[model samples]
Target: MLVVRVVPVGRARLVGAAVRRRLVPALTGSAPTASILTTPARCNSQLAADAHRRRHKNVITGPDAVALRLHRGHLVVQHPRWPVDDAFFSLAWLRDHCRCRHCYDNSTFQRKTDVRQLSSVGNPLHFNVNSTGTVLEIIWHDGHQSEYSMRWLWENSYVGARHREQRQSRLWQRCLWDGRRTSAEDLTSVVYDSFMTTEEGVRRLMKGFLTHGAAVVTGVAPTPAATQAVVERVGVVQHTMFGGVWEFTADGRHADTAYGRDELLPHTDGTYYSEPPGVQVFHCLAHHGHGGETTLVDGFAALNSLHQADPAAYELLSRVPCAGEYRDPSRRLHMVGDGPVIAHRAGAEPTPDSLLRLRFNPYDRAAARRGEPAEVEAFYGAYGRLTELLWDARRRLRLKLRPGTVILIDNWRVLHGRASFTGRRHMCGAYMARSDVLSRARSVGLLI
Candidate 1:
């Protein structure tokens, strides 16, 4: 094996043609791992390939390691400065991902190269790392040349250190909290004017919201228009059958229990939708009677507890698809959706690190054939266990929603409910798309 060390881009020395040819390994019968070429069943194809590269034991390292090389039909790279995997990228993948102006249009976010047309042009006539070691130049047999910056490659490489950091950062941003770790007083809050007018206020709110899955803006003018304004400030209003920025009082204005004067258990909204809203806003305009307090529960915290207490139950919830629906014959509306209560991250399986979102709304669930007798029993048992944790007093934060205060909860991560009230309670709020929520989080530098 040819050994070489990586230096700072500015300090890297050019090694002419001799070094380049030597980096291309000889025909030693060694081949890329099978795991790298074939995706496993029920796995994200890209992630599965990445996982293999990340776990490869023959990682190029050491003081004399060849940081960049061509082996068998793959480009292997290892940056000494970071403790990441030895990335083995196939020539085909590299050609398809070329971001040159000819292959990609930067201005329009459009791709000029069609992946389907790259099969005949995957062969690289020659490949070279520039003297600065910051750019990789590849000349294809088809007379096309592509250049990729080392930084860009690292960012896009699934096995790179940056990729690991990004995934871990998202997981770390979520700090699970319960009644013990947080309280009504400890729930994050910001001044309404500051939140509406300043970036600093938005940053504080977003940080808190990302960390705890909930936040409050105090002093919001307790009106439907004012509440709508606050919702729009964070993201575009997600319109549903309920309309944008809806107002509801203690009357049968809607078919759901929310329109009545009854206590609602901790649950997420829009379980019936294929893609549920990311955030739910609530601003109480008036409450004439008593016993109408908003309840907040961190679904993740409950999930963590369940995972530790009963792995089997947690696994069941992560695998079984629960059917949810919203029906109203009078209004001619009947929406239906289904998914695992504990949704895994995209392309991931039922692992702790894969837990991405939660969908828990017992009231809105539609009847379904839950499989075999044993499976049905297990599903219900797990469902009941999770519900118990969600209802635990020690895991809940109850607070009275008052005028001039707007509360926003991550419907994907937090469960919310209301206490039974006596007289009358009027409120206005709207739903926000999950993408917009993450977009704001990314804009404020809370997420990458």
Candidate 2:
């Protein structure tokens, strides 16, 4: 006959001992199993005593011993009587204070409470295992207590899976800023004579280009010649039917044309081209107009709103790639890209991939139609939603372009258009390929 002894430890020790005692008789299958030699009453009494010992040995006095070590940021705990690994301590604390409202109802919104404000406190209020050790609770400075279960804490604490999905649904893009003030006396000479003529200016310009996806250069003359000066310095000027020279006329007939429309909503220009120029340069030749305010909205903001409103719709748009086309008797071009009206890269901090062109000109859509029903529906749905957000006046920043100001935008990052013009307004605009800027800047050692 063989006898086995099992020692209980932590919460599972008692259960393990009970299982061992019950298995011995079942395995032997003798007349009364191994306990036949002893009286039934004595055997029953012995079993009860063993159960009591096991329960008492496993009893935890104050908050689970494992939880205490974690709050202290201790790497290891070895009291011999109660030994616990770092994972046991670390994971226990996380399980308790999951930013989710189920554990901490600090706000109606389930966003994690800001920890930045707590930096001033040496050791701010934190949730921990209660003194009784049976349940976990938050120990507030005011002496309030909120108990939470281990299972609930664990479930909400590790939200990496959900976070990954969020990142995938955002769009990422850049904006540009030149930081050159208009007040300088020799703004052009300051720009031309300085390193801007050398390598440093090129680098600074490229840095702004990469940062904001657009930039402005002051002191440059807002003339066709000045436009050429910029084109010569950076990249090839992007040309369009309304390129090189642009007019801001109140003539109703001129307004009917694409270039003449006043009070224009936010829209990416040149959606009609198969490959819209990657960047746009507008030199303000004139701006005496009263209401022709140039409004700019961070397309990134619009994309985020769409994502939060309808994640499923957003996902569909991102996955389905579509073609945008524009055509006239003389020229026809199409743009091919993947993403929803607002698409984002997949990561922890999601950003917009592109500020999808959203103004729905039926005439343009009709020309671009390749005859796919599902794709068409998806495009219209995303386009409509994006247009609604862009036109929301509150989100925009209205700025009037004064004469001699040059605004360069990453065609992909910005959607430039005009408000109604009450008075006189004239502006010259040009498009420049992004590649041209990169190549020229590199030649000048501005870009590495």
Candidate 3:
């Protein structure tokens, strides 16, 4: 990749300073000599320069230079020394992305001027690569000065196979885990206080939760705010219908079974919403109950097993759409969402990577049927097979949570339930949006 540094307009006098030692004069018939930019930090040391090139797999090197020329109203961008991925940017695009302080906001990193504001762009006045081979200087058709890194352009080039391969390597790939794969390993745990206090500890917490689908945070206070605090450390607090954070206390109600004492089936929460919560957290405030042990299963892993056992069944479930709804007559709230038992990106061909996302919630399903009689029959057959594979002895995990113990789950990947309960059990928890988790992960290089 090319490294770039922009010199201020006033610093133009120093342009020849770098060319004296590093660059030889190059001209295409009376054009001013191409000036070279010098960046000591990136170009001074031989070891650092080698390391930079190695990071990019030697796509661009210190000796590489951007060769600019105007030919038939199209700007030709070439690098004779490297030329790993030559490209041409239209004058329209370059004018739009001018990074000058006046045209773009450095603090917010937002473009203040729109490309539409320019009435016309004819041709560039001049262009050249600076001495150190890091920055590309351009004086555009509209007299707007700009600088860019040759490496950045090469890395982002859409025409090059190297750029595509490099990007795919960094994409977040999911690993399906089941009772057999996860086994006796805890998936590793991090203390809540340490995770809240240090960056390294927080990264470890993220690694455990994101990589394994769920993680236990020990020694968290058995309070509602503590659960909120733990989730807020990684992202913004996600508010939902249940409020910012809520507490469930087995209220012994007859209507709302969630607040009563019974077995909660292995299912995802809030399938009724268009965008379900990405993550769910529960901090055990009090768990004096004997049979309310939490049952956890990896839904994706179960699907993989079902596919291996019966591909026809998996295909049926993937094709039949199921309705998920929430109705509260007294509160006057009813929301519904419809999708297949195994959700996949619409219009995308089926594959292992395309199976990255799915949803299953037998309990929350509304009283609605899709497809014809034969298709409905086929769907249930596949659904039953999937359910059987999920509930098998080797597929489920049963754990009894204690007070001060916290559980964080990737709601999209894992299904959680509670066994039958006898005594009082109070749990305080909250939700987190998917965008927050993804943005935070990408920020710290966890996802890519």
Candidate 4:
């Protein structure tokens, strides 16, 4: 009888689909004809017992004794704690993923091993854990050796990958907030000098921006150039038809009501673009007016509130597509876009992290094509409820922008508007690409 067995190393489980399909046929040639006995890996309880018997290490015994067996071309790993089906890893996979100095380049963080040549490396003839149980040593059929830390192996295992994914999902979850919960004082505010001079200040700015969907920098030089500088520091300028850095007054320079004194409702910009800007910067260079207060509504917080109050309405908004268009005949500019009022990340359910963008701009919104009367009624009913929440004064954070105060908003998450003004109010601001803002945030460790 040809028997092959070794003591189990650690609590490794979860063989991914790809590894199972590719390695199983390559390893076994066909199903096994002989019986194979295998033991589950040492779980925490077993590790504790092992610790107690460390004085007589390598003397594993009892029902939970560590052991490995070859059934197909896979290393089946059982876990006593789970009492589930065995997990597996291929001998070829083990060899290809060896992180030794020869197979990997730590300096560049690249693999040196040629995966195409893995077939010639031969199978693992024998494998065992070190006395400390921290390392797994394998002697290959071709006399080559490989060693991998138990910690690394566990992390790469199916259970480990799932754990990592969950942790990341939690980290990426947005901290949704409304005006009642978040006030001007609650927001992260930095002085212009500190924000411009210190890396820590920038990191703090990004962290707050990601956490609250908005932040403020005070005491910035009250000039267009200064505002442009501030925007550049955070991210690259996202050029639009308006220009890279745009300044507008209540003059008839453009066609939009933004050039007039009429009050602008709470809405996100670029509803007519497929991919809207992520961040919007506003620096009131001069506001010698009476009622040009800026209104910021946390769209995520509002949606969450809606979800709690009326889940069906929230679902309606998320499921229905709303069309938007922008047309400037003078400039021969016409753009059209359409998407759900609420959007989610690809391949993910509507979790806080996966709720990617909010496309709510009633100004640019176009009439939907005729639909079933019930569907239209449902859509309008949901849209009306959402609008009421947005228009709620208590839920709005109104800021009377003055010279030297700059507000940076996550355009995709927060809605912005302006109160009708009486006198001169010139504001200079720019848009930043979503990728650029997120890249800046990730560079400062705000997100993974």
Top-TM-score candidate index: 1
Ranking by TM-score: 1, 3, 4, 2
For candidate 4, list the clashing residue pairs, or say none.
7-66, 8-66, 8-67
Clashes of each: 1, 27, 6, 3
lDDT of 4 by residue, 37-133 (tens): 3333333334335434542235323333333334445555432322334556676788888888988888998998888977755435556554433
TM-scores, all candidates, are: 0.82, 0.48, 0.73, 0.70
* Clash list (residue pairs), candidate 1: 4-65
Of candidate 4, the 10-residue stretch with the lowest lDDT total is 16-25
Candidate number with the higher lDDT (1 or 3): 1
User: Whole-model Cα lDDT per candidate?
Assistant: 0.76, 0.47, 0.66, 0.73
Give the C-alpha miss distance for residue 113 in model 1, angstroms: 2.4
Q: On a 0 to 100 scale, what is the lDDT of residue 27 in model 3?
A: 21
Residue 222 in model 1: shift from native, Å? Answer: 1.6
lDDT of 2 by residue, 1-448 (tens): 4333333333422111111111121112322222101111112234345433543233222232231222232112211122223223332343334454544667664545355533332211333333322234443333334465433433333323344334433322243212132121212222544424666665566656655555666677767787677656676666665555454455542313444544676666554455456677777677664677676655555666777886655565565544444444333433333222333434423334434433222223334434357677766687667668656766665566777666666675556667776655666667776577667655754332
Give the per-residue lDDT digits (tens) of candidate 1, residues 310-355.
9999998988889899999999999998888998877877766567
Least well predicted 10-residue stretch by lDDT in candidate 2: 33-42
For candidate 1, report its TM-score: 0.82
Off by over 4 Å in 1: 1-67, 118-121, 131-133, 161-172
RMSD of each: 9.5, 20.1, 9.9, 10.4
